[model samples]
Every structure is written in C-alpha cells, then in structure tokens.
Target chain A: MSRSSRTFRGTYFSCMSVQSVSRILAVAFCLVSACTPQQEPDQEPQVRILELQVPANFPEPEKVMAGYPLSEEGVELGRKLFYDTRLSGSNTISCASCHQQQLAFTDGVALNKGAAGTPLLRHSPGLANLAWMNGTFWDGGAKNLESQAFGPITAPDEMNQNLQELVSELTAVPDYVASFRLIFQDEIKPAYIARALAQFQRTLISANSRYDKYVRQEPGGKMSELELKGLTLVQQKCGSCHAGDLFTDNGYHNNGLDSDFSNHSYEGIFQGRYRITHHPADVGKFKTPTLRNVLVTAPYMHDGRFATLEEVLRHYSQGIRASPTVAAAVMQGAEGVAGIPLSVEEKQAIIAFLETLTDYEFIQNEKFSSPFN
Target chain B: MYRIRRSGFYVAMLAILFLAACKEEKEGPAATTSVTVSFQHVVGSEPLQLDEVIYTSPAGDSYAVSNFKYFVSNVKLISSAGEQIYVEPESYHLIAQDGKTSFELKEVPAGTYQRLELSLGIDEELNHRIDHLGDLDPSNEMVWDWDTGYKFLTLVGTYTGQTRSGGLVFHIGGDTNYRTLALELPQPLNPRQDGSSQVLLQANVNELFQGPNLIDFDVMNSSGHGSGPSLIAENYTSGFITVLEAK
Candidate 1:
C-alpha cells in the first residue's frame, strides 16, 4: 500500500520509510483515487465517557478529608474494582455483592449476609454522597474516607479478602493492570485502590431528588399536601440534627437505642462509639446518618433492628432507651430521659416527607453502575 | 565527515544555550524585603498568664482559664502602597494552653505593611465546603469531631464548686456566634533589606470573658455537654473586638 493509504488505517504507520514505497505505485494510487468519486470522511460515533458531571455549585474537593478529586481514570478503575468478585475469598462477592445500584446502592435485605453467611452486625448504609459525611461506618469509627473503604474488604465475616491478596489479584488482570497503570501511574497498591474507590464514591451525588426540586422551585416541582405536612413535622423535630441539603449535621449522638446493656452478650459487638473512644459515657453513641434516600435503604438504625420506617418512627416516638450519653435534647425530665411524641398520622407524614428525598435519577445513572459490561 | 561533525557541535551548543535559558526562567526573582507579624494576647498592658484571674462573672463565681483556643482565619497583610497580600488558606493559628505567641507569616512579598486584618473562626464558605475540622486544621485543637464546626473560642476551666474531674470543656463554634476582628497597626516600619522583620501584636484573654455581656463561669461550667445560645452569645459579645497594638 502507498504511504498515505497506510496512514488512512487507524494505526500509526511510522515504521514505513519513504524508500519502502514505490514511486510508480504511489502515483498510480493517487491518480486512481482522484478519478474515483469522493467519499465522506469516516467519523467514529462518540462514546459517552462521563456519566456524571461535577455540578457548578458543588464545592471543590477539599484535601483527603472532603474526598480525593474524582477523575475519569480513577472512577473507571473503581467501577472495575467494585464489581470484581475476586475481591471476596470465594471469588463471588464484591462491593456490589452488598451495594447493588438498582436498590439504590443497598442490598435489598433486612440484614446483609456476610462471606461466612452470618448476618452482618449493622444495616449497610447506602454509598450515596458519602464524601460529605464527617465520619464513616454506622457508629462513626472510621476517621476518613480512605479508612472507611477498607472495613468490608478485610472483615473476616464480610468479603474476607486480604488487602495484599486483593491487590495481587487485581494486578494479574491485564486490563486492570493497564487501567491501574493509567489511573494511579504506578503498580497497584491498597491505598491507591481505596483512594480510587473513594473518588468514585464521592461522585455519587444524589441532589436531584423531589425534595431538591421543590427547594429549587423548578417547574412542576412542588410537594404534595401530605408531603408538605410531613416536611413541617421533619422541620420541627428532625431538622435540628438532620439539617440542610446534605441531610445530616454530621454529629454523633446517643439516640437511646437500648438503655439496658446488662444483657452483656451484645455489649462488645454493639457498643458503638464507646468501642473507639473507650469512654463509658460514649457507650451507645453513634453518628447520625444522613436521611437522604431513607425510603430505599431499609432495615434502619446502626443495628438494622428496625425493619421499616414505621418501626423507626415508633422508636423515635416511644422506644427511647435512657443512657448517660443520650442527647440532652431528647432528655426531658431530671432523670434525663425523653422520646418524641409523634402521633400515627404524623409518623406517616414524616415518612412521606423522607420518601421525597429519594433521587430516582441517581439510582439509575449508568455512570455509577458496574463497568464489567 | 567534517560537515557532520560541525553540525553536531552546533546542536550541542544550542542545547547548552536552551538549558541556560530554561534555568534563568525557572529561578525568577528573589524577594527584596520581608516582615513577620506576631499576635500576642495581652490584658491591661500585660501578657495574660494561663492561671491568672482576668475577669469575674456576674454570679460571684471565681474564674480561671485552664485552656483557651480559638481560630484566626482569612488573614491579610496590607502594604503601605495599598497593595493587599492574601494569606494562604489553612494559614490559621490556635492560641493553645502551651504558650506559643508567634506564628511565622510565609510567602509574604517584601514591602512596608500598613495593617493586618483577620476573620475570627472560619468564613461561611469554608465552613460549609470542608468536611472535617473545616477551617480549624493543624493550627488549632478547636476541632470537636463529635460536632460539625470549629469551636471559635474555647475557654475551659474549673469553677469553685465543680463536681467533675476536668471541671468543664467550654467549646464554642457554629456560624451564629463567630466574630471577625479587624485592626490597623502602626504604619510600615522600614522593611528589612534582608527580608526579615518582626511586627508584634497582643490579645487579652481577660477581655474575652468581660464587657457588656458577663458570662456566669459557674453556670457555664455546669451547663454540661454541647453548646448553649446564652454561652455562645456571651462569647460573641465579649471577644468580638480584639484590640491590636504595635510593640
């Protein structure tokens, strides 16, 4: 083929020198092409590389604490890492084994079964807008986003994969090898892998919900009468801690889950912030999670004991457990104990209001889905 | 062969010239003058000692500061020529229990500075934007992980009749009570040609508890965990306008 003809192919033709092409063949080809009818330039169809665009009003990613910046290469690597079943010991479970995007990044179960097939200690908090959270895990033990990503992967009862072994498995995949080399610009390390997953998790912003629309005052964006009533109740009661667009004040509190720790059997496993701080006063204190998309991610509370929102509302209304660290706001009398007196109608209304915070678009976004395809 | 050798020599000479040009461009210009501004907390013309009783509350309770820490953010040093130099973000200092009176100002362009202005605690943008510690980073220990925002000013100490071992932890923050203090110091001392001069200033911890709104130290100590509006209000009114003087 002539030099120009070879160049027309997709690959670079740098190996062929000018001396390799015959002048006669080049001239003949040029003349023949000119005599033939002109053809349209071949243009490849554009592939949608980005599923999520950084919002204009969204704050710049702060150093590590706010979250590492989301990059295309990092996110792609994270998506592959997220769906790779080899992350589990039996090569059947990954992050997606528990957090399925269709169910709004939470497995549709009252309690998720771990790799050992034992019910997990707590409900899986959906991985949505996690970058905005001050602390990670249900009880606020993990200090930063990078530290939070490592919990499930190494948990013996959970994914049960060693960090070093996981890295080795990922390095063995040629595609992953190439992708990691591009994303991290070095051989895959556990920290970099965790950081990449965090970058992807940060991009899981779910601000386009019905509540967001109502707040923004977009056309056809308004809450129903029931939703409005529920919203008012939420504003009066829950808005103090679960405040603003992020739906969390990012503070730890003892919401009186169980006052009686005398059972002793559940003491060590479910001691909450006391496990991290080792202070008796900190016992049963857990970080208040953002209530955004509460309707989808069910089996509520740190222990996932409440199977439904109705049960959660009931717990707030009457199921308070008195403790030394129970929030002073929740405590009414001198003995320091109280629960919100939400009525049945009011409970339904609050649930209605919470459902409005669910963003259907975020759950179905192809960008955040498994990249195995 | 001679022509090839000559061309090779010319290329080497051009490469050397290119490298020399690149080096000159990279080095740029050196700073001609520099000044260090030191903020000292002083009460009644004397540096406020840690245990010294500065001010008493309305309720006859004896008050002594065991710990005092606060954030000073968005600092700027104004030049005599009216040029303003912005301090880098996270360039804040926490006045701790352990005495460290001076914070070294970095990357300040050499010039005669007229005044210094700083925002107390964090600005609203930075407060909402950052997740952990917010404006209070390594410079301050005002960060309470259990709470969301920085403690604008923390004055924790024992009251005469406190039952607790540590006495009390007076942590204050949130946008409601944080106050921005700005001051004009003595005009530009001659900029040291060697690019180093010290500008000393002082803060009075006593003034932080007194003035129009008197904080009942005993009541404040016993208020128990979390912050109260009354305490926050007192913090805002008392420590709002910190007087700055040149030494």
Candidate 2:
C-alpha cells in the first residue's frame, strides 16, 4: 500500500498542476499517508538502496547488482564482516588478512599465510572490479562472490572456520544480531553472511586510475610517449585474454605456465582450470586476472612465481613452455620461439603503462579501510 | 428519477456479485492437502545402521557406511491422466542418514496420483546459488565450498578391498551428475482434504554399488569430480529408491 501510494505521488508530482483536483487529492492523501522518505519497493522493505556509480568510460556490467542489491545497511554490515576476525575459526584471520586495501586488496607476498600459518597454494589476487567477474578464484571454481566467501572461510589452512560455529559467534554479538535482523530480516545464517560480504566486495569498483581517466578524456589523463606505446603493445599482445576496459575477458586460458599436468596434489592445484572442468584441454588454464593495479599486486601468476613485471614479460616473450593446452595467442613468435617477441624497451614501456593503472584514491580511500582501525 | 434508479440497479448488481464471490471463496472445489514422504534407508535387506553394519558390495568390498546423505528435489506427483503436480516453493530436501529423513510437501490438490518423479540433486538453476536457507544451506557441510555446488550425495565410510583398504568418500556432485528417478506408487494415492497421505520410500544402499554401473571401491574409492561421480550417479537412476507404499 505504501509503495503504490509513493508511485502515485511521483506521478502526481511529475505532471499534476498545483490547481488541479488530482494535485489537491494527492496533497490530501500525502498528508494522511505520512509522506516520509521511503525505500525502493523491494521485497526487503527496510533496505536503503546504495547506487554504485559506473564510470562514464566503463561499460555497465549486465548483472552488477542482481539477487543481492547493494543496500546502505547491507554494505556497512558487509564491511564489518569483511574485517571481522570472528568469521575465522581462530578469531585471528579475516578476509582483510590476505586482501588488504593499500596493495589494491592483495597482501604484499608471493604466498600469504593462512589462519593456521600454512602458506596458501595460490597468490592472493587483488580484489577490484569484481562486480563484472563471471567467476571467482584463479581457476574460476567458485561461480560468484556469494559462493566464493565460503571457500577461504571454511578452508582448513585459511580461516578454518566451522560455518555453524561462525553463525553462533556472530549471533552472540548483540551488534551483529541487531544489524543482521535490520538488514536481512531473518536469522543470521551463512547465506545472509555471504550476501552481506558480497555486497561490500561488489562496491570495490576501481575505475579512477590514470588509464581510466585517459580513456574518459578527463583531467590528469596526460600520458607520456612510452606509456602510449605500451598501451598499443598491450592492446596488440595481451588483449586476447586481458581484453576490454575491465582489463580481463573473464575467461580461463592456459598461458603456457607449465608443460606437464599429471600432478594431482592439493586437489589438482597445479592442473589449473582443468581441476574445475575436468577437461584435458583446460589443463594449466586459469582465469585471466585483471592488470589493474598490476604495479602493486606482486608476485604475479597463479602460483606467484614471478616477483616482478619484467619476469612476467620475459615469461610471455621466452619463458612460455610449450604445452598442448597453451593458448594459441601466446604462440605469436617466429617458428621455433614459443611466445610473443617483445624487446626490452617494449617491456619497460608496458610496465610504465601498467603503473598508471594504480588508483591512489582507491588505495587511500577511508571508506574501504578497516573500520576497527 | 430514471438516472437514480439506474445507479441503484448497478449498486444492487455489484452487491450480488460480491456475495457470489464470497460464496465461491467459502465453497470452492480447489482444496489442498499435504503429503509426507518418509525414507527408510537400507543395506540390501537389512536396515542401515551407521558406523556398525558392514555390508559387502556386489564387487565384494566390505564397507561400513559412517555417513550417508543425499539431496532429493523437484518432487512431482504424476496423475493417471499424465498430468504432473509439482511441489512448489520449497521442494529441495537434503535427507541425511543421521538427521532429518522425512519432509512434507504441502498444498497438494486432491487427486489420484500414480507415480512420483524426483531428482537426486539440486537443479542447475538452484545449485549455483549458495544463498539458500534450510537443508540447502551451505553450512550443513553438504556443499562443496571450493567448487561452489551442492554435493548431491555423499557416502563416507571405510572400505577394505583386494586393491585398497582406506576411506571411501563417494562425494558425488556436479551439474552433469544430476539424475532423475521415476517410481510407480504401490497403489493410487488419493490425499483427502484432511492432509493424511504418506508416501513411504525405501533407499537401498546396495543399489549405489550395483544397478546399471557396478562401482568397485578398489578403483572408484573417492570422487568429487571426474568420471567417477557420473558413474555413481547413474546407479541411482534404476534401483536406488522404490515407493514402498502410498496411503
């Protein structure tokens, strides 16, 4: 009833004249109906809609905020949960433990330690522009953020949390109980916990980088000659996988990381996307990570084998091992050569261009920083 | 006077229509009843007692089932006229061996049902989404956190065979492994308005090893992915569940 009444008021305000009988009726109706601020007519009535501003240069993602819309309360709850160590079994490690804000949400380590001090198998990928990612993780195993949160939280070496116990822990906290009730209007379940964390992560949009500015033709977008050359080289060489303005095609590929795929340790960690798909062609294939903040997010690759951009470039130019499942685009060199031919100058230029992707505003933004601090 | 009479006639007609609508609401033929589907798990002919009973498979592997859990969803009651009456809102059920084994399918129309159509796993549309409550809840440990899908069926136990003597984890899942089972009721199930109908089903654990695909614990000891899960899933299509009775 309140929703329909609001719609009627909106229509009346847009077209009705002050002297019109309909306007008089609307005014009288509003006076009786308590014309206060109302939420969007969603199923969850109390949810205060938080609009995510897609940059002018960036294409709007098809399903940016479906199923779980970004609500002001939900984001705030998620931000708290993201930083809260209570989600972990030991109450020591949180999502923020590995995904820090300063390094574009990546811990500055090749292999970050888990809650139990065990080194994680894969390098912690930076979290930015995740709203557009069709899948999560290096192998794209987890379909989305909601499902992705369960991985690290329950992982024995990671947060090592028993989800049921985590629910009880959060439920014990009066503040969490109140917030969960206010936002979800249901009991504090793992599903709602995931939805909240997902809402916060989806808001981690990083389109304010210098490269983004240059594309948008905005101020402070001036690029040097080398950087422009690097951009062209990247467009030519890396655009097949790291395609589009989002800096990722959001597809899996084998960039010839390894030649063999027989190893099945750690549940086929070395097998790459083949672990998820069980397809022979998918062996050594991994989801193409975004090059945004590539300067800060090191060491590179799925296993974090490369510590610098130079090593990564060298891998593409020469270090690419000949594998059956390797991407066809990676084999762009002369007959015997395995990878793209890139001179030292071109690699340096590409590195310089990639540095421009580091968004200072996003890194220093207090909104994304730890609330406890 | 004629205009006032016309308005009065219209008001009278509206009142009569409202009365008719109310009468229809009170005495409508559309009545709903609930059906209680109960599961009785077994190992061949004997009752499945967790952690104690060691049952030998067709492949001659002595295995004691420590835990057995599976999802039963998309329940549909088929009429003799070939019409399907699907259970709505919440049809997905996670029936665990040690936990809840029975659930009620509410709002079933009064009809003579001949067979029951059920799926062994969550549908593709619902499987990917982890934001579900109740039995489909990810916290139940019936979900694969890394792979982001429900483990349609998990039979965890220890097995001793000629080739191997270790844990048997048949954590079957994946969208491709979702199997549908159609079973004929013992008799016509005509649920009354009083909601007193029960569909009793017996799940023979031996069927998981035997059926179209005979699974040996020696080779296919554990599987979360690959061809092993599909082989185990195929076994359920035939002799896994049977309608014991319908009352």
Clashing pairs in 2: none
Best by lDDT: 2
**lDDT (Cα, tens digit) per residue for candidate 2, span A1-373:** 3210101112213333556857666645654444344656674548688888887877776485334668898998999999999989999989998999999999989898897687889999899988888789999899888899999999998999999999999999999998888777777999889989998998898999999989999999988999999999999999999898888898999898889889999888889989998888899999899999989889898888999999999999998888888898899987746899999999999999998889998888888888889
Worst ten-residue run, lDDT, model 2 chain A?
Answer: A3-12
> Per-prediction DockQ, in order?
0.01, 0.29
- For model 1, the local distance difference test gives 0.64
Candidate 1's residue-wise lDDT over B81-125, tens digit each?
665453533455565546555665654556566767676676654
Model 2, span B198-245: residue lDDT tens: 999999999998878888888878985788888888888789999899
Worst 10 residues of 1 chain A by lDDT: A2-11
Best by TM-score: 2
A248-342, model 1: which lDDT tens digit per residue? 77777788888765442332447777755557887777777778888888877776788889888778878887777787656543465478878
